[model samples]
Target chain A: MKDNVKLMKGNEAIAMAAIRYGCDGYFGYPITPQSEVLETLEAQMPWETTGMVVLQAESEVASINMVYGGAATGKAVMTSSSSPGVSLMQEGISYLAASELPALIVNVMRGGPGLGTIHPSQSDYFQATKGGGHGDYHLIVLAPSTVQEMADFVSLGFDLAFKYRTPSMILADGVVGQMMEKVVLPEQRPRRTEEEIRRQCPWAVTGKDHGRTKRNIVTSLELDSAVMEKNNERFQRTYREIEKNEVRYEARYTEDADYLVVAFGSIARICMKAIEDARKEGVKVGLIRPITLWPFPYDAIREAAKNVKGILCVEINAGQMIEDVRLAVSDSVPVRHFGRMGGIVPNPNEILDALRRDFIDKPANAKED
Target chain B: MTREEIIRPENKVYSRPRLIDDNYMHYCPGCSHGVVHKLVAEVIEEMGLEEKAIGIAPVGCSVFAYNYIDCDWIEAAHGRAPALATAASRLNPDKVVFTYQGDGDLAAIGSAETIHACTRGENIVIIMINNGIYGMTGGQMSPCTILGAKTATSPYGRRSDLNGFPLKVSNVVALLDGTCYVTRQAVHTVQAVRKAKNALKKAFKNAIEKKGTSFVEVVGTCSSGWKLTPEKSNKWMEENMFVNYPLGDIKDTAAGLEEKTVEVKKS
Candidate 1:
């Protein structure tokens, strides 16, 4: 381990990162396997050091509104929860989107349909990438696969959130949330002063300066249909700008591969191992891991699909991200899904077997074409 | 007297609060929301907090309160104003933060948010306007709808078994250790309006001093909702609503009253 390196859970990294990044406040409710996030913040006492407020709210619903209030003041505020809790926060999340506020939401996802388990699952991929809440809105979703990423994405998420004045989410699964790994903690940045906040966030509701400035109102409600439609158009424009500029992904060994593995979060790590084993067996395989799930790496996947004969979407859920992969390649290459449902984490060997069975051995895709 | 002389500053006995915007209000005639809004605006102006005041408008007739009050405002989701106010006040301890809520928003859908915010002792002011009926949604039965009162939803007149008793949310919060001040007031008469304004001023001062949650409930009239004229609605509220939801201070730790009886549990 290096000077900056420390072994910690992904959940712990998120708390540590938030403090170092000078987050103004964190309001959350405890839910496993992400309860460690709140516990770590409470133990660290960021309030005494960086003056970051940490509060255990009565419920996820309350915590999200707290974030909304803090965000309206142009403060860096956030909340973390698991599936059921995040589900309870949908209305607030939609309001955040409609208000065009900047905030962070971390979802250490667990098995669900309804409290399926406290174990790892990527079933929330559709919920995160598509709109989890009501209204035509999108969250800047960052999927972290490692403890290092868990620490890094906090500042990055805040940066993008403030840049666009929109909500950002770190969509990590239970595996990444619970597993321990080495992380290089970022340097501490001081929290912004009141004057700095007022200047940086002129649109924020930091109160009118005794008529020196115009009153700022933070709200999502617009009763006029014509005006609301214009607001929706503006949101759509912001989304288009994000999609064009923020698409992010990491591609490995796709240059000579006959098949590609598309995945994200913890499952991407599993897919990478499967690809390594497949390459050793003389069956060329590669991996494409999307870092930003909302502004998904459609172009990168399409570029990689040019060389690959078929693509396999490996997830912890049945087949959520496969639809996106299909939409990216658009029948130019055959795309299939391989996954384990209900909190089960598939081994590398199982993934390789599926890859071989579906692509190499049968080549069922080629015959169908 | 000449028109110019009558309009002189010395001749002026009353003036509207500078914080109140010139836009027309959307409230029904004789609705207490307008009077309450004016009182809030006046209090913020009188306290010299017109610039550093943040108001949380709940989902009800007062949802457009932000338009009338010239200050930084956050229009919160229905009944979630207290939760929003909690963070705003905590983050900006030096600034004034308050929530404007109605009966249905405060006592029904937002009951958990309201109760918990008080229990947490958040340094915020909560202004609850209890009209005994849902004014915005075509006069539906609200949690504060009195026993035997008639509403659209309770057309048969609220029976004890069929409909629950009216919720005295102010009394409920006054019992909580987090509250520094809790009072119920109204604005039906000129004298009543003066008293209600004083209550709001005290509440805002408590919020500025960071003395935990200060709750002020205004038992007011809803003319259209009650299917009565504005003047009759005020009389009805005074006769019926006042008996159940009585006025006067339920708790006032800020005035050193009941300091020994109230055990404060820090949040």
Candidate 2:
């Protein structure tokens, strides 16, 4: 068997992985649950001795715009905050997307309608997957369940962001952000050469040099309606391609199962444990965990629908993911939802009981296999 | 004509353009922005910091100052030049970074950013032009406008009961410990222009030495707002404005012990 990794908190793993991965800048304002990230960077940055810029801005707006400036220079920059801070950053995030700048933002969600308590909650699922800012754009949202995944996703998120020339987000709740678990970091890589960055992002603000072209203008102001429409259409094409190419999901024991569980992030972790317990009790249950929440794992959900008798959507929010599950399963299978709200995390045993009562205890009314 | 009576070649030596080019400036005629830009460019060249210096331009009239100055320039959003300059200086500590901002952009919209950046003691320079009115917006009253000065918004003259008094930005910024240099100067005559240029150069040099944030506010003339010729506007600034906003160093580390008493309180 493979050896388990050393234990670390999710936020600590993110900060370490970001440092090791050659991130040049970390700009953020402190908010609950995500403060560990800045604290860790502050302690570790002096020792690294690299050209790392870590600044605690006055507000979330300033932090995000700082990331904007760093990203405009083709640097690997990131920021993290809770819900209210993230809300303040919507304008800058929209501008970054419009400029097609590569950046990373981590959202450690808390309960909220306005100035909500700083506790673990998945209420931001819709805000993350949907376009959080004005205009037609999307951020590649990665939902991580484990501390190991948290570390791995930081590097992966940067890679995807640079590849797509779009911002990427690691959407995690307070539990995933604060929980401790074993994580193994990836090997470090050299910084990208100036020539390579120029080739990759020719529009970066590198200043005008001799014999070079005039400085490029990075703005989202297109006064002409036709030109604006064309830009929007171009973004749509890119989004469609991303949907086809980057959809990631995991399926466990879906073959000839009577019930399938659909979930993501921390809620998915609990659902997995519930599936294992139900299996021990001879309940034919499986799991479908979506890794990419934006280009959601719709294809996997559709494929699992062929054999499972029913689908149970589990989440920390009330009936949020259920809509997506229904969209994938259509009317072919019966889909039920079990969730908790306002920083309350659903227990694995409770999920297992919901699965048994919904699938194993009920007689087949609309079975597929 | 005799050789002495003819215009000698040596007379053209000092008359040659120090900074401003022969091209027609895009600014409205009599705009003090042209004079201020020339002073900054001359200072940069005099200090031999052209190659290693980066300037940030604000969204007001000075947004296009980069076109006139031959150096690395980054155009920032409205009132965000200071924040941009802060990040740029942090990223390249060895390079000299400065921002050119107007009264509306600096004192009105970006007051928070300006205050925070100064408080952080960022190793950068901020050159603010206080013209008492928004020159770019066709003469709207600004935060630095004099009390009872009439403008587009304050058609009945600014009142103490309604619009409050003029804000002294240099005095406000001088209260931050992070700032190593703070001065309020005016450019109403040739001599005042030279003095203002020297003050700006000193601020830039201080920032380059990694001393701390250095700020210089130049009390400029808005001929268009005052409905006067450029020469008359300069006289108006010298006769009226300089009294309300004096031309001198408000805070500087090298000045003396008395000046250091006004050092900004560190958070």
TM-score of each: 0.97, 0.85
What is the DockQ of the complex in model 1?
Answer: 0.77
Residue-by-residue lDDT tens digits, candidate 2, A135-213: 8899999999989888999998999999888999999988999999878876665556556666777776555433454
- Root-mean-square deviation of every model: 2.1, 4.7
Q: Give the worst 10-residue stretch by lDDT in candidate 2 chain A.
A: A208-217
TM-score of chain B of each: 0.95, 0.90
DockQ for every model comes to 0.77, 0.27
User: In model 1, what are the clashing residue pairs, if there are any?
Assistant: none
Query: Which 10 consecutive residues of model 1 chain A have the lowest summed lDDT?
Result: A360-369
List, residue by residue over B49-86, the lDDT tens digit for candidate 1: 87779999999888999899889999899889998888
Docking class of 1: medium
* Top candidate, metric TM-score: 1
Off by over 4 Å in 1: A1-3, A363-369, B255-267
